[model samples]
Target: MIHNKYFSEEQIKTRKQQMSSQWDTVLKTNEAVLIHSGEPIQKPGGLDSTYPFLPHPAYFWLTLRRRETEILLYSKDLGWIEFHKEISNEEIFWEGEKNDILISSQGKNINSLENFLENHRFSRIFHLGQAKDASPEAFELKTLLDKTRRKKDASEVSFIRHIAEIANSGYQKITSVLQPGMTERELQIAYESEIFRNGAHTVPYETIVGSGSNSAILHALPSQKIIKENEFVLVDAGADIFDYCVDVTRTFYSSGEMSSQHKDLYSIVLKAYHECVAMSKAGVFWRDVHIHSAKVITEGLLQLGILKGNLSDLIEKEIVSLFYSHGVGHLVGLRVRDTGQEENLNPKTYFGARLRVDLELEENHLITVEPGCYFMPAILESAYQQKKFYDDINWTELKKWYDIGGVRIEDNILIKNDGNENLTNCIAKTEY
Candidate 1:
């Protein structure tokens, strides 16, 4: 385990340096740009979460450092500017204020929140209000920053790998205690407990614990349903550390039977998943990876008698979408679906092409390579009865394993110069 370090001023300053470098990429090119500490979240009333309350991630990313109720703006003309609430004497008496204490883990010297940006002069400074009035503030600083944050730097990559490490530890705890009689929620709690017990401030997203047929649902949430014997369980979960995240999914047997059907499906999914992961090299078109995965899915479905048509015709028509509708995967980082341009592949050709921005992989980009095949009885019945692509399917055998649910192989990856790095390797998503 890495030694835990609390937020300190030095760390804040170091992170600030990194943020400055990241901001330079976009801001340096524009004639005049405003880098803003994001607006505060609204509380129950009209009040905003301020000085003592936690600032949102966008706020943190731009400022590179902050305390409750503080805002910072940056531009070439106005080096670095700050804004804060005016601490009235009456307010101080009502709530004891510690003026000298370090506000951030980084030892940013203390200052009155109200006095940070009092006399700054920009052609126009950003304000936290409706978009109509601010002519000069045309673009949202947060949106622009989101686009910039898609790819991780070395430090951000380390943070994501650290999150994956913690998730692996949680996976270990669940493995030791997994059994048939346990409810899905029971398993979920156990998994989340381990995540929080470690350094994770929050989970990357909701934890999914789909057992048996529930696995067929692509994005199943954990419920109180009990797992059964001779059933396959699928779990997709992740953790967030310092705002960076890692997502992973695994399927296992409650009875540990390792059925032939289960093994066969696992093998196919793993094949498609790994093939896509291996294709994540610099300069490779993102659509090519999805095409490769689709081809593998087509061949696997043919072997299983799920699809029956001219292979080329079927692939061209996207007949395999019935079983594999989602994309190969998405970019991963600070946000589970981190920010980047949604311009990787053409939107019309790829089902979820919007998720594939920057399709040609770049060095240090992180992505998720998840490929899945599901036998959804509802989709099958509706499409088959209507003859909607029915000519492309072998209905008989597919119905035989209809209750067997689905299989998805997912992993978080780092796109490298020559190849890729699998960050979620330790999270154990499958028997493989």
Candidate 2:
């Protein structure tokens, strides 16, 4: 059985009030006639079982409830209204009683949903997308609530901090007991067990415990491969606490003694990590931060004789994509990849092309700053085939480190008005 916990009633009320105010402003400004919530979903093949229900982040941001068959309707004059199905005794016996924590805490006004369609009709309904139960005439909302969700409120920050603490504890547990010959799968179990023991509801994403050559794969799955001495282990994992997530990554040397090449590469990645953290502040464009991180990695590779050309010229030519392809970071909140976007930001560059969130940093914005360098044959070979950066890259020297795999150091950061705060700062770096 899974144990559940929630924020205090006062905290829930505050979040509700904030959401209501935001909705009020949005409805009035857009002159929306009505706003309708999306419906829930169920599994296809299961007889009576449903997939783990995760409410739409926008819906949860408003109602905090993960109900399966409920809809929220809002109007400027009527305020927020909920239509809900009355639970039967059979359901109570089979599925357990409805907690109604949100209703009781906020004293929400709910109405029978049996005849909702017959009683109400809307001409201009704003919705995120089409739903089976929603009106076909509904028009898409120009700006989604995702934009407003960028800057978290007090309660959100608290939840994320708790997640970070849990993640830190899990990392500490794994590092203290890790040993050579342990399978990647074993490490995954140990880390996940620690997360559950510390009160995390579930892992935010798949637990990555990549060892040896597997570390070169950015999103490698934990396998039965046994870790060996002198190899690197890249563990990128996080836990979910009440839907809030914390993403963290750490790379460790299996022998507990870093090789000369490993030391040099680790130092460079660590420097890039800290430099990105220092540069993440309110009003800073995320694209600029990404570019700065790529430049740092490019410069480091050049110093290591891995690349051959002027630093600026190499970076401008997208040579950094050969090693550090993924984005330096992304927004983190209710979901691991939080929903938000900037109209002017384009994340189509060869480097940092997979950026999930691209917007100017704002106060209370939580994100992950993960910088990495990998020796992946496919990515490098593809670039070489395209004749991209052939002059800047020293393929012969890079080939020597192919077996070295990769190194990544990641942390959760909260952007502040003055600067930023690293939420996972308590977690020790793998260099130790």
Candidate 3:
């Protein structure tokens, strides 16, 4: 089906040209822009071994390539230029052929930047990547980049759909092999193998495989803990073919039918996922969607006796944060947990601090509608101490449900003016 990677050189060049127009609007007579493909870090205590390298999101947005230490430069005069680190015969021998997603960017040697930097010395540079003192402040330019990134281009939408299909294969693998006594790590291997085997260029992030009580620990690495009977196994995983991304999470019952209690918790999260996804049309505020998910979850919790309070008060007090922590989801594309230029949204807003992307939902935006309900010990404990909202929670009732751990069902959503699309809905939540 030709889905491993889809960005062609021509498409990348077209994207670059679009960026050039944006750059032209910002860069003055002598100003330039330098976006960096970041350097790889050597593994600690290992002299030569290094972790896998994924370029800076900004740099990858322009080049769609994954070479380290490369630079994409833009100026009104020079237009678009890529500077590849001059390679050595030793590097060529060890690394073999420098094959990458081909781009027609005929760039200069990194050393040539010495002459260019000295000659044109930009009046005010707009930098979008790292490395020290590379350019001037990039406040306005970054805003342009972030605003542009919020909406997926046509090719970006196509690639995300393809990756979601690949990721579903992995989810199916885990669901099929689920049995008692298997360690979480073993399940992770089964899931990862299928994705890579099915042609995912890489996993967008660490594949999470948490079963039983461990599932409450969001983003935990798969462990050796044995999977007991029919407990919940929560997996948050996705695929990356050329860094085209999808972040999907599905919680599964280890064996046959789940218990009624387990079913209730799962259903709550499932309902929240549905409600949030349905709310993802253009012009809706993303934060309002998050609150809507919280309301749905709080309603479920109230029914289950885990929480007891007025719906509005429960949501406003962040009482739902006790059970459903973390933002419903964030923008997922060129990078997982995208480094959104959305400013410091991460202020301890209690929906688990890292929740950033909160722009008004717009057409063509790709986001994740991942509302979760967990019986996390840490969150429950802290909320108990918040005396003001103390009476609202049913702390004692939560004890009975702690063993179910957590339940999260996520899907990538493509926002539209009329409606929204659930890109990963094929990775089913029930009756599989």
Global lDDT of each candidate:
0.69, 0.75, 0.79
Best by lDDT: 3
Q: Model 1, 221: alpha-carbon shift in Å? A: 1.1
Best by TM-score: 3
Poorest lDDT segment (10 consecutive residues) of candidate 2: 133-142
lDDT of 1 by residue, 1-432 (tens): 221333344554565555456555545422234333344466566563443333445555544443455555456544444554455688689766634322433222225432433544334444432344354333444444554555566656667777888998888878877899999999999889998898787787789888888998988998989988877788888897645689888877788768888888878888998788888987787778887888898888887777786777777777777778887877778667776453333564553333345367778778888888887889778845438776777767777888888888789888888998998897765545
lDDT comparing candidate 1 with the true structure = 0.69
Q: After best superposition, candidate 3 residue 63: deviation in angstroms?
A: 1.8
Give the TM-score of each candidate. 0.80, 0.88, 0.92
State the displacement of the C-alpha of residue 376, model 1, in Å, after optimal TM-score superposition: 1.5
lDDT of 1 at 398: 75
| Window of ten residues with lowest summed lDDT in model 1 | 101-110
- Of 1 and 2, the candidate ranking higher by TM-score: 2
Error of 1 at 377 (Å): 1.5
Query: How many residue pairs clash in each candidate at the backbone level?
Result: 16, 0, 0
Which residue pairs in model 2 clash with each other?
A: none
Instruction: Give candidate 1 misplaced runs (Cα > 4 Å).
Output: 1-56, 64-69, 84-121, 124-148, 340-346, 349-358, 383-386, 429-432
Total clashes in model 1, counting residue pairs 3 or more apart in sequence or in different chains: 16
